[model samples]
Target: MITKSIKGIGKAVGVMLLIIFGVQHVEAQQFFSYSQYMNNLTPLNSAYSLIDKNGTLNALLRKQWTGIEGSPSTFIFNGNLPIESINGAAGLIVMNDQFAVEHLTEINGFFAKGIQLGNNQFLGVSLNAGIRRYVANYSSLDAVDPQFRNDVRENKPNIGFGILYYSDHYYVGVSLPELSIRDLGNASTQRADFFRNHFNFAGAYLFGKEGDDVRAKPAVLATYTKGVPFIADMSTTLYFKSILGIGVNYRTNNEMSGIISISSDIIKLGYSYQFGTSATNLGGRLSNATHEVTLSYRFGQNTMSRSIL
Candidate 1:
């Protein structure tokens, strides 16, 4: 009887694993971006749109788990413009994330209103609306299980809001991407279930005088979901002559990274490399390397000539 019970438990565990893997495999592709912590600047909070001094454009590309087959890759493009006359800003973001054999494409528009505070501090409130397309390919799983035959496509609409407070030397923000909504798709067969809420907080501090040619900037970002421990990212950047930048970052339970950035009067370029740690080391060197790049351009008039916080 004990042997039979053990066999039953093993079968149950196997079935559970199959279900979890199948569901996660599809959902994983929808949000497969390593630099999500940075991308959250827009999707997580509307107030972040007002953080920039001038009209700016930015792009990001990420590749994770280098040697692993069908690991994850992502690309994003976004632009923001501050309407100084009304203390408001407008922006748009587009992203494509791929993991395993699944993919997610999203486009969102954002708006933010900035309110002046005492002593040069400011607060901003932001809102965002967007659509996400989720696609999955189950052909790869056919060899493992012939019963897995549901390869489908889905699209969903979502809205998010955020608040931010900042000054020349420091900044902090909070945001929720999905609010409390659930089941955003209209398909008869449920393709995916998005989290009801994703909470984020970030802050940055600057060291050194404003006119100094070099300065140290330290920043931290934290994220949380229901029933999960908080994940934090700590990073620091050394800026030289207001144009060149070098930085390093560490993500809890994940990886360590090095970064380089350049900003001019018209454009900015950034690149980052992440090396996996802990259990990730078992995946081989190539599998540990993750890469990211960002590009930004300015438009319209140049009112504020510096970038900080």
Candidate 2:
């Protein structure tokens, strides 16, 4: 009877571990979106808010792990406008990320000042302020295990800041999007909590002649966080006649991606597809790849008009 009881307890413990691991995996915080290469403007850093030459409004939607249950999805909307009179710019960014029963929403504002570097290059410094909210659903877990009967839903607030330095062709930035600490409720007379710190570096190079009808642009982005290892993305895109673009990307430990962009005088459309690597097959289950799309609009002085003037 003692041996039987021990085996029963071991089985229960195993089940609980599996349940917790599965749920946390779905909610784990991984960087979201593919176009982060396009100037690292995800609101995690305030410096990118002023990088654009003209007023830019962009939106990105990402669907990760397509067929998997409770896969992650993210949406981002951001806009930036330079204030020539003040020699700086102000911008806004908003994002929502969802995984399984967990969700996070963030909103931020950014300000930047530009310094002329001669030779048509300029340096910039930026500041950002943001708010975030995290929400979890405990009811969903109660249905799967009776041990979760006492689980309660919870919400928390987060605040963060960042700084960035950039030129026309390259940028490097660091940000802590969840720098503030908050209590996680009472448990044994002490509150348990965790803060998020994100560090980022990015750069791009333009080649193949400035006046050529076709050009090649290469870019790289790297990021690190307190609890996660470094992640890098390298990509090169061929611009055709200054209106269309095609590229390929390799993300460390993630996926190989193909991307395309089409632009008119005022609007641009972009899309990317990520193919799962062998690491995903290790689980004996075919993982769904990621799909992303972006739309952007540039208002005010057109590129053609600037050239002519």
Candidate 3:
């Protein structure tokens, strides 16, 4: 009887969370995030298609809230390259996110062109076009209410834009990753805001020797969404001999993380561990840390700017 009661309560809670997520997902932010954003650019800013000189490929995987049921997980794969014939840059991004009964998959293409601003400084403008495929399963609910729908799936169009300015020592960018809002269907025939516009501001600077000397980089990323509080992150990283890197980061009112990475001519590997803060402070002490891993490779002979590291 006790076991049955516990199962019943779990299902009830799941149903409630599902309903709440569905409602909030429309008006609120419905995006996946990574703690180590420094290594990634195109995910937030389409203009970053030209951030690096060599053709690049990157993959990132994140697992949030280990040991927790219905936790969130995200996976992303993206690639970018400069097209000398077109005198521009192009990229492709694919991402998958899953939490509880909700799943989101996105496939996007990016195009960017840069304007020289003298002294090796440049400004870039970009456009992104994509599709979002969303899926939800309500069959897990113990009691299927009339308001609940099962196996909901949808495909929606998405568009975004960005601008970036950069030199050897510093870089700044602003982006609207989701400029077009989408309406996900509701059970009652009333359409709700399924996707909202997301604005992102990001900047980074490098200090120390511009050549072979050790360097320190500090970076920040801020995001804003309608009807939701703003979120920001700050981080500092140290690079040794342009091959190894170590860093720490703090997400405002969220969590703290440590990272390590190794880069080579062939590939780069990075790993991060995040400890929860605030309400999850106690839970973090119980080994429920979030984990993330990243892999990136650069090909071709074109050299990337050293100042943007």
Candidate number achieving the greatest lDDT relative to the actual structure:
3
Question: Per-residue lDDT for 299 in model 1?
Answer: 73
lDDT of 3: 0.75
Off by over 4 Å in 2: 1-29, 33-36, 39-42, 143-146, 149-167, 172-178, 181-195, 281-284, 302-309
State the lDDT at 250 in candidate 3.
87
For residue 63, model 1's alpha carbon misses the true position, in angstroms, by 0.6
Task: Give the 10-residue window scoring lowest on summed lDDT in candidate 1.
Answer: 24-33
lDDT of 2 at 18: 41
Best by TM-score: 3
* Candidate 3 or 2, higher lDDT: 3
Per-candidate count of clashing residue pairs (backbone under 3 Å): 2, 0, 2
lDDT of each residue in 1-309, candidate 3, tens digit only: 777657756876864664454333222323667877887778888787676777888899997667756666899998988876655789898999877767778899999888888887989899989998777766554334443435677778889899999876778999997766555564213222336677899999888765565888899988887756677889999998878889999877557899999887668899999876655342344444789999988887765543236
Cα deviation at 115, candidate 2, in Å, is 1.7
Note the Cα lDDT for every prediction shown: 0.68, 0.62, 0.75
lDDT of 2 by residue, 96-129 (tens): 8865555667777777777776665666676666
Tens digits of per-residue lDDT, candidate 1, 1-309, equal 677656645544544443444343323222333443442366456687786768877778887656555666788887888888888999887878775656778788888898999887999888888887777665444423444456757777878888889877878988775553456543325333333356778887878877689989888878776544456788898989878888888877456788888877777788888875655342233355778887777776663466655
